[model samples]
Target chain A: MKLSEILSLLEGTLVSEHADWDLEIGKVAAADLMSDVLAFADPESVLVTGLVNPQVVITADMADIVGIIFVRGKVPPPETVAVAREERIPLIITSYTMFEACGRLYQAGLKAVDLES
Target chain B: MSKVSQVTRLQELVYELEIAEVMTRDFLSVTPQMTMREFKEFLQEHRFSGAPVMEDGELVGIISIEDLIEALAAGELGCLVEAKMTRDPVVLKANDLVVRSVDYFGRFGYGRFPVVDDQGAIVGVLTKGDITRGLLRKLEVEYHQEEIRRARVNHIFDDVSSDHTSISLRYDVEARNFERGGRASRSIKRALKRFGLPRQIVRRAAIATYEAEMNVVIHADDPGGVITAEIQPDQIVIEAIDMGPGIPDIDLAMQRGFSTAPDWIREMGFGAGMGLKNIDRCADRMELLSPHGTRTTLRIVIYMDER
Candidate 1:
């Protein structure tokens, strides 16, 4: 899905100045463990997590995650926001819990890449 | 023994710091009314990067060794804490996640931050050294965990006698997604380690394999391609197969500045034609094969002793 469309669907607040209007998203993983995310997330997708550390941004930077979403009312620290801005990956804040958020996106015709997609 | 470069370089550092067992007890104090001579002496006595300043028993500010040095150079040792100390020192609670400490490192590149108590009393000092050592310790622990994962990756490949023939990854191309792009490689690296591959081999293979996988998704149109990586006792082979119309000039494609990747890829600091060169540079042996509708296959060999 187009990043623009995903942002609108998730009720996201864009925290990045470098987000492309045309960047497409290929997959999404919702978790907070930086290691788990690093160990598992498909680097072709966005990271949706309840955690709000700057490492999230650093990890995103290292992995090239297209975007970061802070779920369940978690707010990013200023440094976290700054890194996101510098890396130009979109940072979004969503009030949905991880499960609900993942479910909503999963059901929103927001299909994740199948092992064969 | 030349591997001593990596192994011995860290020994003295680890040895010196191991003495204190990484003290977290933030024992320090400085009074603004204290003489400048005294502050400079405190800096020297404690080997301080910085110290918190107090006034009437109240935490008022901080004096960094940097500021003290600057004062000395400026012939200002007689200067008061008000003059030499930073009025506001970034302080953190003793219980703050060490990860947050890392964030501070990433953000301001600080050498240290003050640790304070509920009453604003300085409890201890967290040096860039301490945090870094802490991170190293944590990473060491994680590295041990990674050993298991490395085994898994190794089992996937080396245990040809086992079940890991092909890694089936489901991903989309041109998504500009960063986080998921390297997942398969992480797994691959872990498996390689499990198979007892050397760290150098693991690093080189991971880079070449991940870079190849990332390119497939970020640059190619084929979502149907399979990245098949295999391990031989002699070398590691990574094959990225896709149905996308292949590049015309293999040589030009190998050139460092010849990437046709979109602007986004360039902005990510990777899509430089160097991906191929980087793969070539890291691998002792590399073979890239592409035929129209052509799958790109990269073979990298990391010698056992090399790691």
Candidate 2:
């Protein structure tokens, strides 16, 4: 799924100024634990989480996770937002909870990290 | 003894010591008039492999035991030092870092270097052993200073903590404020990067922090949440606390694809229920507390050098 489509589906606000909204997200990993994200998330996956700390951006950068979507109407602090912008990782904030965010993306044909080919 | 301390000590040594402090000042020298046979006897008597060749207090060349052996093999023992010594040898300035001299040693595969001053006069001779001994002395002084600091800090704190140095950061997550999400995690990431933590550990810490922060923003009621991250030489610890609507069924919440968020929330692309599970997966150790909607607390720890 393109970042723009995911943004529209979740009614997300783009928190990172430099994110390529047109970037393709081939898979999705929805988690709040960064360790799981590091161990399991594939490069180019969109990280769907309700976790709003700066580590999310750092983890995405390390694991090569392409984007981040903060769910359940959560807003990350300015510092976290700045990290995403600096890292050039697309960040979106949605009103959906973790479950709904993952489900919506999954239903839209964004495969889970494990299920993706 | 710890890896953190070892790296810190190495950094201190590399940044602190200069070549002049380590070079030997009273080094033997050979002049061009000295015969190869006489220089060979001098090297054997002193158990030295090399010495600088000087003429009128200026470095003219360098003579090694190998040069004598080569001269002897070629029936040139009667030749003067000028015939055997290497002229215009590689040299180091006294003000240069000891680390730079070490680099020259590695690059040139030389046993010794002539230390020179601004006037092109040879001031001393530096061998690899000299540099190592100097660094050891510097390390001892650093350790002594560290011990005094630790003693003072312990007296003030009353409780002796682990030896590792640490830094702490706090970030606030506001509820239902989409515009400002991820600010805390972003800053935490920057701090970790500044600390030069391994890329893997930084990433795990960051992911766990984001998840914890999000939980407060999404599930907590009214007052929002706070995340405190403590970065240590060996590990990173993050704690997220929030005013509650705590999870009623912890077991169910830990499962994949289970959530209690409203349909609108799902429409916004969340509520697939992987928050706690993800945090659990990322943290080397995790503690979660929720006693029926009062407060929810989550702690995540990641070791910095697991590999």
For model 2, how does the per-residue alpha-carbon lDDT over B1-307 read when each residue is reduced to its tens digit?
6989888877778667888988899999989999998998999899999999999888899999889889989999999999889999999998888889878998998899999987767899999889778878877887898778666543432453666557789888888664455568767877776655676677777777766765676677876888899876567889988878777777878887677766644444445577677778778999988887578888899987664
Worst 10 residues of 2 chain B by lDDT: B152-161
The TM-scores of all predictions, comma-separated, are: 0.36, 0.43
- Clashes in predicted model 2: 46
iRMS, all models:
10.1, 6.6
Model 1 interface CAPRI class? incorrect
Which portions of model 2 show Cα errors greater than 4 Å?
A1-40, A44-63, A66-85, A90-117, B1-164
After the best TM-score superposition of candidate 1, give how far the Cα of residue B238 lies from its true spot, in angstroms: 1.7
Best candidate per lDDT, number? Answer: 2
Using DockQ, give the best candidate's number: 2
Each model's fraction of native contacts: 0.00, 0.15
Q: What TM-score quantifies how close candidate 1 is to the native fold?
A: 0.36
Residue A42 of model 1, lDDT score: 57
- Model 2's DockQ score: 0.12
Evaluated against the true structure, the overall lDDT of model 2 is 0.79
